[model samples]
Target: MARRGPKSHWWRTRLLAIAIVSVWAVVTLALPFFNSISNGTGPGGVGIYVFMAEGVLVLMLALVFWFARRQQAIDREFAMAEED
Candidate 1:
């Protein structure tokens, strides 16, 4: 009988991707509005801080996705080697 690989990691990666996109959407859409309402600042007022925060979030999300893709590639290579 052929062996089936584990699938939990696949689901976990999918969940992580979904969570990352959701958070990115929230940060991109909500932060500026909240900042403006709370700080009475427009996109040019203390809004620089909001932009900085969004930039950090984008960097983090990019790192996370990159790491996940690298990990998947490594896993695929290992699996192929094991099948030989």
Candidate 2:
């Protein structure tokens, strides 16, 4: 059995996290600008929106992790065969 280090997929994990946080940040920053024109539909406040986005981000990140791991496995196998 080969031992793989956590760093193998850490970048993808961190990217997913950053994307989640960015969603919250963008919504929070844009709400004020959007309100200046007309009402569509948005979070009442930043705090609540953060909670909502956090949930979405977490679910999405889990899926990202699943896919990334599968892809990594395929890549590792191909690399090993190429070395032979």
**TM-scores vs. true structure, each candidate:** 0.46, 0.36
- Best prediction by lDDT: 1
User: What digit string (tens of lDDT, one per residue) describes model 1 on residues 1-84?
Assistant: 213445744655577677767766666667666665657455475556756567767766786888667656545643532332
lDDT tens readout by residue for model 2, 1-84: 223455645554567567656755665556546554444345555554554457556755776676656555644643421332
Over all chains combined, what TM-score does candidate 2 have? 0.36
Instruction: Give the C-alpha miss distance for residue 56 in model 2, angstroms.
Output: 12
Error of 1 at 39 (Å): 6.8
* C-alpha lDDT of residue 83 in model 2: 34
Report lDDT (Cα) of residue 45, candidate 2. Answer: 57
lDDT of 1 at 84: 29
Q: Candidate 1: misplaced stretches above 4 Å?
A: 1-6, 38-84
